[model samples]
Target: MRIKDLFLLLLLFSSLLVNAQQKEIDSLENYYHYSQDAKRMEICLELSALYRNIDPSKGLEFAKEGITLARHFKDLKTEAAILNEMGVLYRKLGELDKAMLYHKDALVIFKSTNDIMGQAYCFSNIASVNIDMGYYEMALEYANRSLELKKKLGDENQIAYSLRIIASIYHESGRYSEALPYYNQAMDYYERLNNKTEKANVMLNKAIASSSLHDDFTPEIVDSLFSQAQIIYERVGSKYGVAAVHFHRADWEVRVENYTAAEQYYLKVLEITKEIDAKVLYLKALEKISEFYEIIGRNQTAYDYLSEYVRLQKELFSESKAKEVASIESRILLREQEQEIDVLEAQQKTRNVIIVMIFVLLIAIVLFLLFFNQRYKEIKRLNNKLNDEVTHRRKSEEKLKESEEQLKVLIEDKNRFLSIISHDLRSPFSGMYGLIYLMEEQYDELSDEKIKEIIDRLSKSSSQINELLEDLLSWANLSSGNIVFKPEIFNATKLINEVVDINTYRLQTKDISCRYDSSTQFIRADYFMVKTVFMNLLTNAIKFSDSNSQIEIEREIIDDRIVFSIIDHGIGMNEDALKKIQQPGKHVSKSGTMGEKGSGVGLLLVYDLLKKHGSQPEFSSSPGEGTTVKFSLPVK
Candidate 1:
């Protein structure tokens, strides 16, 4: 059949599946109105699970309702189940951190309840979230834990699921050879259970892995596997599975140099993914087709497809979508507050009834008037205590509001930091692309000198990108608190000289001379951190210095501390610019004297490393003269 006809059939099949799910949801909602307490919570959980793939927002609404009911009924198991389902929904929505939080919360409850099965499920969910967040090692660890738990429980189906997760983690981490055996084991289990959809998924993944193995699996064998998976997917009416098969088939074709077949397969993937509204898959298809076009020298077509892919990606992760997610969370919180208010109102009504009954009894017993007066006084005192508690709660709420505001500021800073990194990274790639395109399209028309200059520019751009990436990674590690400060006695002079030697090429390029006294100076500090600080400072000095300029590296003993300084006859910053650079969370980048690029992450990293060692770098600079940076470390 033609690919278009095949996609049409797939679309029709997907519509049927969607309709079936919708009908089931409607029936559950109808039954929910007639149910009470636990049954209602069960319905909510079911609906949430059903809506997870179709509409995560709707799933979240149902999950919230389920959580409220489960808590009211004191059903910890059900609450944990709902929480896990909510995590899955959030993962689908691309809120990975939120998903991880929900999964961890579910795991805690499962542990408290001693529910091994629930705990296994939570581990698997957490593994899935870690996989989404690109933490493959953590994902593998959790997946193995889940598999062990499933094995202990002797549940073959759950064990198979865990095996699949483990295999996927390996696959995503580019350990396809290791992933193959796990996929085989999972596929065997699904085959034994006669689970056609899952069996097809495993077949597809196995085929992809095999294709990536080059000579290990023949092209014919890979083709046979794809055919088998497609047959099963069509029989099960799984359009997603079929689309995935087509996407990988395209990749296999490209690997085998069958460009025409790859193009057709890619088009089929796009059509099927778009028809089924599988946006992530659709985006992948768009990106692959763009690359495919570029490889075939169809530059305009490639550019068009790339533009579309970028637009779609931005749309997927837009600020407006982030705000929508925030709105959903806010609404959930509001609902919880409303539920609390309802409970309080019910308690207040019961108390009022009790007080009225007591008053009536007191009216009948005039003999105990003194005792009644004393009781009334006690009740008034209790009321006053309740008021005091209310005031305290209000104050706590105010503090919580302040904390939330601070969190918002932090989030904004994080976003801005990411934006700056993105721009800096993109600038070099953009220049490289233009240079490459010029080389490709007009190589014959250009002179040897021009070609050499273009190559040099490409090299420089690549170097800048590399430097930015290194700085970015270091900053990320520092910000995440992954870098440990392991202080040990080390020769400060030697470390400084080592850093200076590392930048020897840059210094020679600028024709700048660096002078340092060769004196042994021992200091207690993190060796790697100190080295990084020295590297950044010296590199910055080299970048900003004029040709034939002098840089002095000085060390002085002051009591129990050793002060280190790097001074350069460079283009110095003004007061305003220096202030901005010194401030925390401020990313400042400017061109050097020779038009060299920077990511502005170097100094931030320097500041953080020094801060960890109980010191801070002080800078002195004016626009015309030079700059000096000094910091201290313990001599003991």
Candidate 2:
């Protein structure tokens, strides 16, 4: 525990850490004393990166100074390399536009010098920034540019890096199909190079593509990729990369719905990310945990997760996106102006000689042949590409048309069936009425007591039949899209009372005390549509209640909306029974308490009617306990 002992212990720890980074460190150290200033600048940039975490401000300062020195010494190659390094650091610092500016500047310089490898690196860097910024179109453009440059230069390593950047963009943007080929290419190149670290990075990207597509990620390629990334990350002493590896592993497990393993890996990523101060990685970890909790029906945990997510979102988006976009455009304009000035100078130097050499007939013949061949090839290629696209589009259009026709046929059939059933049912019930009338007329003196009973039976049966017919027609009207939604102001409290009065006999039959504590809020809704919902719900509650059971009706104004609920502690449905409840026109009659038969069309009609006005009943119920059905009415 002595000072010397502590120092030695620290030294030993440092040695262990550097041992992992020794390969990169040694390569950089050797490059430091190289003969050229460009080579020296390359080493300095890497050194700055290695120390970025231990001291960020110093690292940034060192990288900037190296870039300046490279530029001052007229070492364009070194300048381009240093710019890429600065871009990477700026990207880590969350300065996306600044990173892009540096990368683009380097790209222009590299192209001027015909430094193809440098140009490819710059393109990849710019593409990465675009990906993070959600500019997927621009990202793909830069990625393709990088690929072209790398392929022409025949620098396989740079080509691999280009492919990796492209795959990362596609993977991040939820484009699995587009991403797969790029990952495969990157992986192939890394394998050929035997570059363990880069190979692992590419492998992780491939795994990510698979996971995004929801492919089965078992102990095969997924595990292999994760293990490879872990190894290479540890070998390079890159905590950030290590965190990424852990995050990917956790995400892979999440896709397979394995929450426990995902949670463990997320925790590991969190622990390492804290030391590295990687805010983005921390946000990603929080998002993954939130999604996992939601699948298990943990609402409170999901809420907490979303809160953190929204907080991070505000931090990223609420600041200066417009300013950054404008600044980039302004810079592009300035560069174009400079290019115009350069072009004018070149024209001045070549004008006289170019004019003296002009030939008419031979040039015209050459141009004609060139244009003819080019036009033919262009047309052929376009036709070949568009043939399948046109066919697929035609098929999609036909499917849509067929679906519409089927829907129309189904609607017509339902209307016809309703008309037939209602007409037939009415005739039979009407015939019984005629028979009773004839019996009363012919045998008026049969018996006074028997006559009284027959009249009562006639009244009850007629009432029941009328109620059934009303419900069936109401449902039919709503289903055939004949219901009108005319929003008007009405006192909802008074409306409920009116519905209560209309159904008084049904309520009185069950001896149920109907409690109404309506809110004093006037609502803007379709009057008839809202009334239908209230009456149907109240009737159902009364029908299901046992004798002397109290039906509680309540209303409230919450969050600028009218909420009316009928809560009854009666024969509530189990979940299975609730699932069988039909939509409009799907209901069959069922007997209520006191032998009062139900018109199932009432509920189905209510559901359809309420939904037309952008509202529907929500329910909470338990078997033998109760039910609460409420609807939300929009306010003016």
In order, the Cα lDDT scores of the candidates are 0.80, 0.68
lDDT of 2 by residue, 1-636 (tens): 112222222233344355556667567767666635655666677777775433333346557768877877888877777777778777865678888888888888888999877877788888878877889889999889989987997889888877877776776667776888888888888879988666766666666666556544345766777787788878878776677778777767776778888888978887886677666566667666666677777857766765665456335433433434343333333334444456578933322221222222234335434644563453244233434334434654574566457556555545544554566456547756875986668676657777777777778778767766676657645653456678998788888889989988877877888888755668898898888788788988888778889998887778878787899988887786666563333554555656665656677778778777777778888888978888888776
The CA lDDT at 342 in model 2 is 62
Best by lDDT: 1
Task: Give TM per candidate.
Answer: 0.45, 0.36
- What number of clashing residue pairs does each candidate have, in the order they appear? 0, 0
For model 1 the local lDDT of residue 122 reads 93
Inter-residue clash pairs, candidate 2: none
| TM-score, prediction 1 | 0.45
The root-mean-square deviation over C-alpha atoms between each candidate and the true structure, in angstroms, is: 32.4, 29.3
lDDT of 1 by residue, 1-636 (tens): 122232333344454467789989999989988998888899999999988756777778889899999999999999999999999988977779889999999999999999999999999999988887889999999999999999999999999999988987887776878998998999999999999887887887778878877777788878999999999999988778888788889978988889999999999999988898887678878878888887888878877776677567656645534655454444344344444566476833322322332333333334234433553453344233334335434654574566457556546546645676569988999999999999999999999999999999999999998988788768755753458789999888888789888999999998988999888888998998999899999999998999999999998889899898999988899999989887866778899999999888888888889989888889899997889999999995
